[model samples]
Target: MRLTALGSRLRTTAWPIPFVWTVALGLWGLSREGSVWRDEAATWQVALRSTGEISRMVENVDVVHTLYYLLMHSLFECFGPSTTVLRLPSVLAAAAAAACVAELGRRLSGNLVGLGAGMAFGLIPSVQFYLQEGRPYALVAAAAAVSTLLLVALLQGRRNERGRWIAYACMILVCGLLNWLALLILPAHMVTLAWARPTVRTWIRWASASVAATAGVMPLILFSRTQSGQVSWIPPLTWHMLIGPAILLALAGVGALLDRPGARGLSATAVGLPLLAVPQIGLVGISLFKPLFVDRYVLFSLLGLALMVGVVLGALVEAVGRRSRSSARWVLPVVVAAATVALLPQALAKRSPQSRVDDVLAAAEQVERLKKDGDAVLFVPSARRDTKSVSPHAFTGIQDIALEETPERSGTLKGVEWDAARLRTEMLARQRIILVTDAGDVSKPADSPRDRTKLATLGECFRPVVDEQVRGRRITVYVRSASDSPSRLRCSESSR
Candidate 1:
């Protein structure tokens, strides 16, 4: 009797542990002592821009992220900017998601499984990747996980629990609005409903909630469709993508089969399996038909994988403990410690600028050092002309000679481009010119009409001085000399 009561008390008291760890881990490098990437800088830039500018910019581009941009705008207005202030929302969102993962695991399985699952989620690499990001993804995951937890609660409760059902519906809307991709979880949720043969009233409650969520996001969904070009860069499905989901599901599948008693209903396997499997499989399969296979977009799906893994790990630890009674207590802790050590390198890497592909901070700093007073900058291709958006302080003294309108004035992320004649005039105005372009563009034809105008003029009118490559881009500088000739630098209108 005493042992049984003690077990129950421990389970009740363990709810806060996962949340505490998540917050601590999420805040580790969130202050951004390292470099800030373009995407991170984008959140800062868009939020602080005058509301009207942001409003106008989204009308043509970035319509999908408008809601998130407005939320950050309000946040900046309320709290003066700080690195901590900027990313704290994501930190807290990750923590809440971790906690919810634990709670859901406990509801579906039992105490030990919940603890393991929550810890797995808090430490999982993908979750850690976005935990401190200023973007909407971490919050999207938290909202989706919280909504699923509520669904689990409703399924476990009495059919009369209309309050839980209603809240679940609202949460679905919040999750869906946070990121449209999150709505994919709803179809995976059918697995849970299928597992429970509910009464007519329960069926009615589920249908009503599902309909409200679908209805809530229809307008935004329509708008996002028009902005599909934004994600046109998403590549078609590949072998690596197929291999990744297959591995996650295989581990989760094995765990489901090995789950021991004390785990609650069929809900653990039913909910976790579909949550992990359906989104990845369905998304990839859909990608084969269309092109939407970016892994970061579905980061929340890992929580399902972690939950299932926790149950499996818990069962394994317990089984080993029984088999080796003398060394039982040390076995699980040692195994967990070993796993933690293995994950330490990835966790440490997240603290550096290397966490992102392009270090906008570093690239901007290099530009600041390269150019002198009266020098003009040109962003080739015009589509990536948002360098000033990354480091306004660094670019403040430099001029963008080829830019027709500033990104904010033009109400666009990349800013409006100058026509070839205007660009030639702009280039002629400054003797010292600095050019920045994507590193990937290096191998493109140097003399192509679209590209050669900038470089051709550079070679004819000036002498090459510095050519350097940085984190995500390349920068080159040239200065006018006695050998310069305007006629040779000029391009015909037909070429343009």
Candidate 2:
């Protein structure tokens, strides 16, 4: 009995193992070979701004990421800016999440299940993708895991119930502030409440805590509606997106069946099943109303999936133990090892530059290489201005001929550009123009009149001196055609 007690104590402290393991995984290719995608470029730019600038920018756009931007801003102030400093918070947050999953599994199931779940959390593909990302999703995932652990502790009728409830509410609040979509976890917890069938008092306490947390984030939710255009780029829901959730649900369902959780118990299925399924289904439902079904929105739900994986591993151990006790001991390690080996290629790929849609730094490098002295730069559709915003050094002596206001001063991303009439007047004075834009395959049709004008004017008045495509971005150097007189430079612009 003492030996069993010793084993239990040792297992409780085993969270650090997964924590360390996840840290190692996160640090393995921490910089992604010094690649930063456009999304991270946004983070980097906003984070480098003053708090007042961030406040103004959020009021105009991207209010959803305000808290994360402020957090990163503070980090930047303390550490200065570098790829390591940019992504280190995510690495630490992911490690904390892995540790929380391990502790949750240990308390709810066993030491082995806890360790398996914790380790499995790091290996999950979505988790791995965002694990090194310099964004708030990983931090939200960590808060969600901590909140779930607190909820499990509350359900277990542990001491310090009041304090745990407060912590739980704070965790939810943090998650919501990071990204309000994380409030979906509340419905997930509601499912757990139904499964556990807690007493009236417990339910009231849980309801109060949940309500308090939601109320804290409600103002942000309402305010963000004004900035809804940030998400307008998300396409309408399609059948193909359903395949991923369907497979996830099917796998979790099998794990639930294998665990066969008892009614009204804080069993693995009781917590994990609801955690895994409810948020995903809830997001799908939201998508039905508005196309907001991004997989990363409910990334916290991966914890539920990891817990279920642990249950599945536990089931395998039990089945194998019936045949040979010694063999049962090998079940988890062997399975984890085999899974790791199978995922080796994917793991390496996630650490590569090609893992993302585009590399902002690589594009900046292309600008540095192709740029000649006194060349003026133009960003097609304007958003590509992020390349210059993220790497201002590469753009030294390069004029943004059309920019009317800087992004920081204008309280907007990508800054403000002159009207097409003024833009053409400005462009006519420039001898060499460096055009930075998306490559042909990824470039969207120029929607705004200004963008259309930029394209048409360049096509009519300039000849391509050098054009190169690298890492999903295109750099073209256009020298004004001497044969083209100002009369011939008359380019038509879209009326709208």
State which candidate has the highest TM-score.
2
For candidate 2, the lDDT comes to 0.87
TM-score of each: 0.91, 0.95
lDDT of 1: 0.75
Q: Which ten residues in a row have the lowest lDDT in candidate 1?
A: 1-10
- Rate residue 493 of model 2 by lDDT: 29
**With candidate 1 superimposed using the best TM-score fit, by how many Å does residue 200's alpha carbon deviate from the native?**
2.5
Q: How much lDDT does each candidate structure score?
A: 0.75, 0.87
Supply the TM-score for candidate 2. 0.95
Candidate 2 wrongly placed segments (more than 4 Å): 1-10, 260-264, 484-496
Q: Residue 193 of candidate 2: its Cα lDDT?
A: 84
Candidate 1: segments with Cα more than 4 A from true spot:
1-9, 158-160, 260-264, 323-332, 440-452, 484-496
Report model 1's TM-score to 2 decimal places.
Answer: 0.91
